[model samples]
Target: MFRILAIAALLSLPATAYAEKLANKLLGAKEVASQQAPMPIGSYAKGCGAGLVELPETGPSWQAMRLSRNRNWGHPEMINFLVDLSQTAQRLGWAGLYVGDISQPRGGPMTSGHASHQIGLDADIWQLPPKRVNLSRAEREKLSSIPVRSADQKSVTRNWTRTHHELMKAAALDPRVDRIFVAAAVKIEMCKTAKSSDKKWLQKIRPIQGHDSHFHVRLKCPAGARLCQTQKPSVNELSKGGDGCDDTLMWWVTDYLNPPKPTKKPKEPAKRTRHPREYTMADLPKQCLDVLASP
Candidate 1:
């Protein structure tokens, strides 16, 4: 009993130490400012300079890590971005948003995008009610479909909505958000709602591909964090008003869920039939003797 107690005490110390380090990293984070009321997606600090924080290093663990695709937390930039989001939610009279996962240390050893989440700073946000919240299935679904405004005050609803547009508009008011990965239609609606002042802010955001399965919020890293990695915006990255988000749901439904189209085979040419010859006996020659014997 004494030995067990001693081991438990020792284990608790490190956990406490780890928690403190993480709190410090998050507490001191800062956000970039947007001059416009409804800032554009990229108007907020982007890439690696948005005061993003990371989960602290507490050494190694012996437990096995699990892997799953669509279960990755992007980077430190995401942390700072969420902080701003949570605060914005609170300021708008809504309950603070829950951050589901961050900094998958095992990379996707047990999950997908291990390379992206390798750093101790990235995380995932979900509309799923926090386990403590105990929301019913219907309630959860409703939460997931709540439509929130994009920063442009446009009625852009994410793939997963979680409340009113005011909640999203309030979150966008922050300056730490770098960009948002939303549904194509949502992006289009947002661009339309953008006011002249909001346009200045909206122009900075670059919308990329994403699923309605979940809303991905990425942020720039905070100052002085070396572990934070930078994601280069893709060449295909584009803003609103260009081919209208260029969405391709066709591949999603056909290639992933629908059966592949069958390939057609070429038909073989038919063999031509020849008319029986009247002088077949002469044509048979020596072979005719063998045929006659067989008969």
Candidate 2:
């Protein structure tokens, strides 16, 4: 399997490629995209992108916030998708979107924050619908997204609006989207209101932890991206075409929020996993070397 080979490669790098600098540092230093034709070179958490483009800092319907981070860049398709979604946000009664991080100029592991945005296919959209899209750089930096989930992690807050639901629904309906990550409480609130007859789109609105302030959108690999990996959905029911409104989804609130105490401690210590920030050139797909070296 591809994952097995990727691990094998970590243990046995060619002498020439061994001891190369951290991929995050090497790739993160790039302030612009590569000149090569557009391609996503690996899996979401382990890949590098080719020919990524910047989402303009400001658009009629969107503003890329936290400009200091210089994270407005993304795959061209992702840029287009964000622009389109911002307009959708405007139609839903918000002024427009206040966009968050997309990816570094040439996608790869980041020096800080986000393990999966490495592919330029993952993006974080603020939960705080913009009150105005023309905020100056200073105001943008100070603004914070509102929490849509309750402090108890059991229900949505007053900030959770009808527009938020519709916005997420509209995004889920988009064929280009692979999945959207929202807080478990938010997903539970949405699932409660969903009509059993029309819940198919809800399948893509995946419930995850700590996204109370924003929703993360991940796109399916673009056509002709030969090296792109297709990640399977987490829940088995989703693959069978069921709306993810079952007991499994509910488990997030009932068990995850209040995990049962360990009845017995394991005799062996669990292995420590390496974070993407620790990945080196040799750890990535072999082609990433060319991507890193490309002009």
Best by TM-score: 2
Distance from true location, Cα of 75 in model 2, Å = 1.0
In the range 147-227, model 2's lDDT, one tens digit per residue, is: 999988888999999899999999999999999999988888889988778898888888888799999999999988898
- Residue 267 alpha-carbon offset, candidate 2, angstroms: 6.3
- In candidate 2, stretches whose alpha carbon ends up further than 4 angstroms from where it belongs are 1-20, 237-239, 264-267
Error of 2 at 189 (Å): 0.5
Best by lDDT: 2
Q: Which ranges in model 1 have alpha carbons more than 4 Å from their true place?
A: 1-84, 106-110, 113-115, 120-122, 127-175, 204-206, 233-295
TM-score for candidate 1, please give it.
Answer: 0.41
Q: For model 1, how does the per-residue alpha-carbon lDDT over 157-237 read when each residue is reduced to its tens digit? A: 353343423444544455654445554444555555545354434332334444233345544444554434445654434
lDDT on C-alpha atoms for all candidate structures: 0.35, 0.86
**Per-prediction TM-score to the true structure, in the order listed:** 0.41, 0.91
